[model samples]
Target: MRRSVPMQRLDGLVDPRQGLGAAEAQARSARYGLNVIIPGVRSGWRTTLADTLRDPMLWFLLATGALFMLIGSYTEALIMLLALVPLFGMDAYLHRRTQASVEGLSGRLATTARVLRDGSQRTVPAETLVPGDLVLVRSGEFFPADGLIVAGEELQVDESTLTGEAWPVRKQVVEQGLFSHIRETAVEDVYWGMAGTRQLTGHAWLRVTLTGAETLYGEVVRSAVAGPHAQTPLQRSVAHLVKVLIVAAIVFCLALAWLRYHQGHGLVDALLSALTLAIAALPEEFPVVLTFFLGVGVYRLARRRALVRRSLVVESIGRVSCVCSDKTGTLTEGRLRLTHLLPMSNISEQRLQTLAAAASQADSGDPLDEAVLSNCPPPVEQHILARFPFTEDRRKATMVSEQEDGLLVAVKGAPEVVLGLCELPEAERRDWLAAVEAYSNDGHKVIGCAYRTLTSEAWTGANQIGG
Candidate 1:
């Protein structure tokens, strides 16, 4: 979600809790068009053909092919025209990939939002939203529209999409209650939830004060991404070489024709002789050879799931040595993997992973839990008595499960939290803490794991383990 810029909140403008009625929403939707910036379809065959023909090499091929047909060399003409088939097909394939990416992006930009309509929460299309509507936004979801966060705590939003900031921004609750409103507050104090940005961690109720072009992100949407005429160095060099070859072909053809005419040859004979030499000297094969090589590069890249927007980029990729990234979803898959295991002397590597998975809820949709679950299945036939969700204050989660022998308690969280809760020798704790620091210095995200077995005498209930 984009960070919503704080705006003047007029008193009596919103109900905050009841939100707008269904009929009012329908009327507003009719007044304002759909919240779309550039609703474009896939590139058609004509567009693909046009883009392919833009290659200067292909233009030379077409001219050479026409000349061949004029000279009745049907075989050469056929070969030149046949070369165009792969160029067109390559472009069509890449454009299809590019269109799919664009559609995926558009899907993210517009999503369904749960909002209060006539005192009841209903899932509605984001584009149908209007100003004065109250909506709910949760973690890992984009804010449907631009609005002010009326009530929420510990709300963290990923404003990097809009602000270009690498860090997550925490939002505060609105200080004044409903109807105590008539103040122009600073942006930092008043929590604003804008469209096109995502909520990173918390849930919030926001009053939609702006929609479509009225929102901050809507301004970005109005300014569309432009595709300019660009060329790689290889392409520029090839084009330059082709220009020089054409000039030389023309100069030699004119000089030879003038000499033959002055030596008593007929104008038609001199012209045909010059034309024949020009056709051979033109070196039209230069472009065909270059196109074939680059087309193969584009094909290889496409097979690797790399979307080559332009064939010229294929050459540039071969020259790339280092790639600087911001570690965002666009840069990488952003999926967590259990790469290493640091077990205590008494614990086996398998036991460590089992305990970590035991503390995790498979259905939680948390990346850490999923990564652990991917490695090992949870303990079988174990009934969960109680489970504590991770919170910012606690910084850890605990779960109690009933097994055949007795009750088992498992915990996983930040290293510091786990070390503090576990009963360890002072020297052992310091050693493990030092290990954790080493992992941190190596740029690894470390999660500490611990488990405890409880006998019947000690297995009271959830309170005995956590409280």
Candidate 2:
């Protein structure tokens, strides 16, 4: 029979407990060093020899050098060995440096969480968090421990780091207290670090459900650390060239040995001469040259705000023919700004202010709404009859309110949507459409606004005007 685990309450802050003193927490964190495996000591001679032999370039060079040695060509063998050793060393150094950098990054991350324990709140290193330990999460904080949200209000989380989403996601405690319908067997309500999310607003307590490598951040770290190193295009081309050269050397040696033997020379001496020729043909300095090229390319790309994940991708960028780009954030600022105001009928600044104020107050905190409110003057004192939030699908916001003279209505949304609802002159509408099209083709996102007056008797929800 399976034993049932009790659901832990995730509320309030955990106090520091005796077992988890500051000294212990610091020591634990130090030991984990941001929860990453530190690079161990370098391998000794035997391991180093094994690694060198395993390298493709080193293997090619070794085969060539062995052939030279067999052919009794000491000078060529020495030259090949000298060239191969430095290349092997460069490769080892680069690999170790990359590994060390990743380890250092991992060490900078938080490894534990402060949680409520034993009816008193206490700081617990994430490794010590039990399956049901209550952990507190605050705004502007990274979730060091993974758990289900048990209590929270008005919480917005920026999960873009983990999910690549550009907007904040609102989180709430589900009525069931646990998200059972989610496909993952793990706690459903608990967020993972792979989603790259962080709390934006409000505070809540979570019961520690997963820790260490099992957490979302752990997965991200694993992926980042385990990602394959990209090889440069030149390196690949050189490797291919080396393979062909090795085959050619083998053929040339065989042919030379046959010719020398036919000309009455000893088979052994002929074989030795053939081996020397093979070693001389091998280009062991190619790797060092390739490394220098890759390093230079990476530095140049970094200056352009592009991080070269794979050294080879730098070369690929040069070969790209056509580019498909996103309009938002890539080309434009992505934030809407007020540019112009067009009144349908001639009105004084005071009347325009009255209309702009009513429209601005009805805005629903969007970029366009913020722009409109910024351009409009504040209302003096007025009550709203009805207000509707702007919806991207509807592309409009409508508000009905009472004015000093009579009832008035204001509307704002995408220019095309407002224009379709307006009864403007045909010629003027065509000109406006042409201007809008021109702006759109020039990559400007446009919005339109309209207003109408209403009599008390005819003031109905459906009668609100728009343009």
Best-fitting candidate, measured by lDDT? Answer: 1
Candidate 2 — what's its lDDT? 0.58
Off by over 4 Å in 1: 1-15, 22-33, 36-41, 103-111, 130-132, 138-148, 153-202, 207-226, 244-274, 303-305, 318-322, 327-333, 339-354, 377-387, 400-409, 451-467
Reference-based TM-score of each model? 0.75, 0.52
Worst 10 residues of 2 by lDDT: 1-10
**Candidate 1 lDDT score at position 24:** 81
lDDT of 2 at 119: 53
Candidate 1's residue-wise lDDT over 309-366, tens digit each? 7777888899999988666556655567889999998889999999998999875546
Q: Write the per-residue lDDT of candidate 2 for residues 160-224, one digit (tens) a residue.
A: 44444434465666434233333334433423221224565567666444555655666776776
State the lDDT at 345 in candidate 1.
Answer: 88
Alpha-carbon lDDT, every model:
0.76, 0.58
Best-fitting candidate, measured by TM-score? 1
